[model samples]
Each structure stands twice: as structure tokens, then as C-alpha cells.
Target chain A: MEERTVCEMCDNPPEDEGYELPLCANCRDELSRCPFPLWVKLISGLVLLLVLIAFVNFPSSLRAAAAFERGNKAKSKGNYPTAILEYERALARFPDSTVTMAPLAAACGWDGDLRKFAYYLEKLDGREIRADLADEIEEILLEFEDLSEMEGDEQ
Target chain B: MIIPGRLIALVTFPGVIVHEIAHQLFCRLCGVAVLDVCYFRFESPAGYVEHEPPRRISQHVLIGIGPFIVNSLLGAFIALPSAVAVLQFEAGTVLDYILVWLGVSIAMHAFPSVADAKSIWQAIWSEGTPTLTRLMVTPVVGLIYLGALGSFLWLDLAYGVVLAVGFPYLLVSLLT
Candidate 1:
């Protein structure tokens, strides 16, 4: 008697040629285009609902990001108070973030808030930063220091 | 000890569906006609997307890795806030837990199956293939095998946790 291998998927006689996986003609065809089950529709609906919930909560989820964006925008326009406020919000969301710390220090220095500038600069000490960004921060610190020195000399 | 693939599929049915949808979406994006898509079912493979042979190696790559990109990004996006609230700050609600589960499940199924690797292998080795594409695809195929093997060892779940929890913390730090 010739040996026959059954289709592991559908339990029918298998075709000699096709995919490496064992399957009958019908099962192979079904593999290509199986009819959708009602359960699939229900599950899809549930997934959609989950996605919708995520979308709804997107703004809340990215609260820190939004604040950070606003901070950059305010800083670009030279609005120091708003910039500091936004950067502070970003920092609260990410306390250990050196990215926020450097920027916050820069904004405080520019705004002439010496105490906060010193505090943040100290906090940012030895924190790893991108070389290019570190250069920019260094330049800003020097300029602010020069201004503060000039004011003290006049006083 | 061998656990049936179908049981895993049934447990993470949502992820399986998303994985198939991701494959089908990539097929559409690559302009390959999808002949069949089994989103989810009580079977050995759970879900699959069958498509016509792609015209280019890039298309083949996109189709093969589509699930990884889609599932990981989507999972991270959905889990960002919830992960922060629940894990980082420890101030999450019931809804946050649900979102965390949903996101992690999607991320967990990001790995491409061994079948996808086999198809990619054929595409790379076939006549008229560029050497660069062949070289590039070999490691990718290796990764698919690794992911398949790792799935058995719960590597997929670990990836899910990273996407759900670690990704959120990273995003928060990158803000601005």
C-alpha cells in the first residue's frame, strides 16, 4: 500500500506540490482567501474602539510634548516668561530630562532670574548632552554672564 | 513542552488581527494585490496575508517588516500616556490598564513568522536579484528566525513591555 500524508490543516489528502506546509487543495485555496467570520467583525470593532480611545487621549498623552513645543515657540519669539512656564511644565513631566534642564536654565538666564538659572545650571552639571546643543548652551551662558557683569559694574 | 500556536493566537487575538492587517496594509502600499487575508481564526497559524509576488526587493522588505513597524509604533503611541501614568508616576485608572494591555498585545505580535522569512529568502536569491538587496535581506531573514524562536521563549512579551513602558518614558524625555 502506498503511504499517503494527510493535510495537517484540513485533514484531507495532501497535494504533492504547493507550499512546504502540508495542505489539501481546498485548504490551500482557503489559505489564500478564507471567508471572514462574524467573530472577526466583533474583534475588529473592539480594536477600533480601542484605537478611538487612544486618539481621544492623544493630547493628554503628549502633554509634555505640547508644553515643550510651546516653550520653543515662546523662546524663539523672545517671550521669556511664557518660555520658562512651558519649559517648567515639560520638566515636571520629565524630571530627570537633561533636555528640559538645559533649556530651562537658558530661559531663566535670559530672563535675568539668576537664582533659578543657577539652580538649573547646577542640576544640569555633568548631564550628557549633544555636542552641538552643548556648544549653543555654553555660548548663551557666556552672553548672559557678560550682561550680568556689565549690570553689576554699572550698579 | 510545546504549546499550540492556536492557543497563543486565541489569547492574543487582537494582536494577531492587527498583525495580519499590517501585512495587508503594506501589501496595498507596495501595490501588490492581496489574494487572501486571514485576520484571526482558531488555527495553527492564527492569521495570514497572502499577496502576489512583489516587483522589487524594497517592496518585499516592506511587506515582510510591515508588522514590526506598524505594531511597535502603534503600541508605543497608544501606551505612551498610560505607561507613564501607571508605571512611571503610579497614577493610572482602569482605562489606563486597558490601554496598556491593548498596546502591549499589539507590540507582542510584531515579529514576522518563519514563512515570511522563507518567502523573503526566495525573493532575494532568485535570478536577476541585486547583490546589495541579497546582502541586506539575509540579516533580516535571520532576524525573522530569531523572532520566531524567541516567541517560544516569551521574547515577544518582553518586546511588548519595552514598547509599552520604555517607549513612553523615552518619548517624554525627548519632548521639545
Candidate 2:
């Protein structure tokens, strides 16, 4: 009698194509896709998660931080218009951030846009402002009021 | 000594069925010819899907790990409502417990078998494999082995519990 070889998986004797680690035909078929590469599936899954997050508009603090950084860079370069736009974008993401509001008010003041400066200052009025920025804002508001009075006198 | 593979299979039949179904589903989606499918058997694996190898290595990879993706997601989804009910102190019906069991079973089977890890390694080293493929497959192979080892420590059950309970709890907290 020919010796029967056992399958590694189910321990069934191989009826055909018997060899070392002899898998029965059924077991061999089952093992055909063994050691399936998981990385490909994981990458695809991660891509799906990113797409889902994008669709869901998940709140991302990183986005707010990036916008804040862009605003700061623009402000430091004396580009008040770009700073204002970026600061507004940051504030839109993080609505209640005093850090964002302070920069926005400063940007508006630097741009000599009195109306927007007053708008942002009024928004900041009830909230506690940082000492340095508060001093600058007070001076800018006073200068704005003085200019407005001079224009009224001329009229 | 005879290994109690059949007994284990009987105990976790839902997982076996979902796992095989996931494989078949991926094979169909990948356009691979499904030669055979055993949804359940008295034998060791309990269930399996036999399909022709896909033309692209990527497709092959997809077919192999497809069960993990399908089972985990399906398990989590099915468990959501039951988890919510249980958290709210509602006396869930027998069907709810069954759903929770089914979900956890499916999730527990989400880890690919050791054979799957080997297949992925082979695919990674196969001829004409892209550099990107090698880069991506390396970490996955490591994780697959890790998960396989974790199974010995009941990490698979832990993973299932997280999906069935932790995820639902998180969703509820977020909404409220």
C-alpha cells in the first residue's frame, strides 16, 4: 500500500499531488492565497479613511494651526492684506480663539482700515486682550477717533 | 491528540462564514474567477473560498486581506445599534445579544491567517514588483505577524470588543 501523506491544515490524507507539508486538494486550494499581503489593503484602507474624513469635514486642529501660521508669516512680512485674509480663515476654523482675534485686529489696524479694525476691536472689547496688543489697539482706536473728528470739523 | 478544530468551528461559525464570504466578495470584485467556496465544513478551516490568482499583485493583495476589512467594518456596523441600546440600560432582546455576538465574532476573525502573511511576503518579492509595493508590504507583513501572535494572547477578542463597544460608545459621546 502506498503511504498516505497528511495535510498540514486539516490533517487529512492527501489523495492527489502529495508531497512535503502535503496538503489535500481541498486544503491546497484553501491555502492557495495564504500569506496575503496586508499592506496593500491597509494602504487602500487609509486612503478610504482620508476620503471619508474629507467628506465628513472632520474638525482638524492642524488646519487651524496651518492657517494661523500663514497669517503670522504674512503679518511679520508687513503684508497686512494677506495677513487679514489668512487670519480670517484661521478664525473661521477656530471661532473662539483669542490668539486669532488679536492678530486679526492688529492686521486690520495696520492696513489703516478703521471700520474693520473697530469691528474686530468691538468683538474683542468684552474679551480679555493680551497686554501688548491691547496697548497697540487702544492707540490705534484713539488715532482713528482723532482722524474722524478732524474730518467732521472740516465738513 | 486530536485538535478540537471542529468544536472551535462550531463555536465560532458566524466568524467562519463571514470570513469566507468576505474572501468570495473580494474575489468577485477583483474579477478573479471563483473556482469554489465552502461556507462551512467539519474540517479545520471551517470555511474557504477558492479563486484564481489575480493578474495584478495589488489585486492579489486585495483578495487576500479583503476579509479583515469586510469583517471588521461589518461587525462594527452591526453592533452599533445593539451597543447603543445596551449603553442606555435598555433590556435588549435575545436578537440584540445575537447581533452583538455575530458582530464580535466577525471582528475577531478580522486578522489574516499566517498563510496570508506568507502569501503577502511572496507577493512582495515576486518579479516585476514595484518599489512602492515593496515599501508598502514590509510594514503590513510585520503587522500581520504581530496580529497573528496577538491572537494567541486574545488580542483578537480585544480588537472585537473595541469595535463592538468602544466605537459605539465613542460615537454616542460625540453626538451628545
Tens-digit lDDT string for candidate 2 (A1-155): 65656765677886444133355667655555343336536744653453344323223333444566778889889999999998887677556667788879998998998788878887887888679888878777788889899999999
Error of 1 at B156 (Å): 0.9
Model 1: per-residue lDDT, tens digit, B1-176? 56777787787777888898888778767655566778878976888888767767888889999999999987886776577656643445687778888888889999988888898999999888989889988999999999999988889989999988887566666764
Tell me each candidate's RMSD, in Å, in order: 10.1, 14.9
Q: Which stretches of candidate 2 lie over 4 Å from their true place?
A: A1-155, B1-6, B87-90
Model 2 chain B: weakest 10-residue lDDT segment is: B84-93
Task: Give, for candidate 1 chain A, the lowest lDDT window spanning 10 residues.
Answer: A28-37
lDDT of 2 by residue, B34-115 (tens): 6677877888667777765455777777877888999899778666556543332233445556666767888888887777
- Candidate 1 residues A64-122, lDDT tens each? 66687778789889898999999898777667667667777878877888899889888
How much is the TM-score of the A chain of model 2?
0.57
